[model samples]
Target: MNVPGDGGKYAWRTEIRTRRLAVPREEREREAEALAEGVAALNAHKWVCAYMPVGAEPGSIAMLDALRAVGARVLLPITAAAGPLLWAEYTDRDSLQRARFGLLEPTGATLPAAAIGWAELVLVPAMAVDRRGVRLGRGAGYYDRTLTAAREDARLVAVVRDEELVERLPEEPHDQRMGWAMTPFGGLRRLGGTEAEESSSAG
Candidate 1:
């Protein structure tokens, strides 16, 4: 079932996954704390769609709490079959349960994919993201499908470590571009698009 253009993506995923696994646990914890702080500083949003990081992913559960503290009613992805993701409200760490793909998901009532329309901001998980807004995910295509339901004005932001923010990455037609990247130390950076242009001029 391999697609013609997927070989390059496969290689990138392997390399990134290996690199993530090499990061020390202590460093990961520190990055998680910094990420939470970064998310906390963003302008408050009424609704946000975010994910719970697992394994060597660049964030922690605290990021959810930070979003909540910033006045967002946070929604976390709940994996279904092979289409767009379902969502559920994130109440607390205690509400999370083990799910498919080794992900942690909230136990609240599941909402349909269209629930993404409620979010004013969508925080996506990426193995890497380029300045061009090309996000390299784990190749699941889940976010790709899910984000199609996001509100037109919703800000799509990728959460990654500083090193994972690069200048370029392979892109596919079906891949959705992120408008911003949130790094642990670097905070929020505008990616390719109108926002990037505005940020450049303001600087």
Candidate 2:
């Protein structure tokens, strides 16, 4: 489908990437620690799909461990050739090995894309996300393709830095909207979307 404002999306990506790279190492580590604390405070889900933060990403392996400490079984994504993401259970830091696109994935049996059905919470990586839940990804379309397999009741949360959560973003029909934005200092902020209403009523 035709996604309006392609130029705007690209511009946003460039700006965000530049900003992320400029973050000082000390601040990045501090933010990572805060993210772990935020996740630890949440009511643990039985199954949580999360990613290992690499480079300038705002989280650390501690976030995954926090989820585990809260009695959740965590699943990490395994990237493949241009389709929905495969999955594998996250055991410990020892289970992670470097994979394509500079990502760290679990060294275990690969689960099919449909395994997303097992998760109640999916922590997505994003360049930025808006209050309306429009997530600006890296333009690879991995999450756009994979999140379709998530359970209807699943929470799609974008993991970002505090500054990456904005008031607006360019969105397209094919883009999957996040229900929540998890930030280092901000914690979890509910976004405006169908999932938000459902989540609020459920609570």
* lDDT for each residue of candidate 2 in 28-120, tens digit (9 for 90 to 100): 999999989888877779999999886787899999999999999999999999899999999899999999989999999999999999999
Q: On residues 1-44, what C-alpha lDDT tens digit does candidate 1 reach at each position?
A: 12244547777777778788999999999999998888888888
The lDDT for every candidate, in the order shown, is 0.87, 0.87
Model 1 gets an lDDT of 0.87
Q: What is the lDDT of residue 199 in candidate 2?
A: 38
14, model 1: CA deviation in Å? 1.4
Please list the residue runs of candidate 1 whose C-alpha ends up more than 4 Å from where it truly belongs after superposition.
Answer: 1-7, 193-203
Ten contiguous residues minimizing lDDT sum, candidate 1: 194-203
Supply candidate 2's per-residue lDDT for 28. Answer: 92
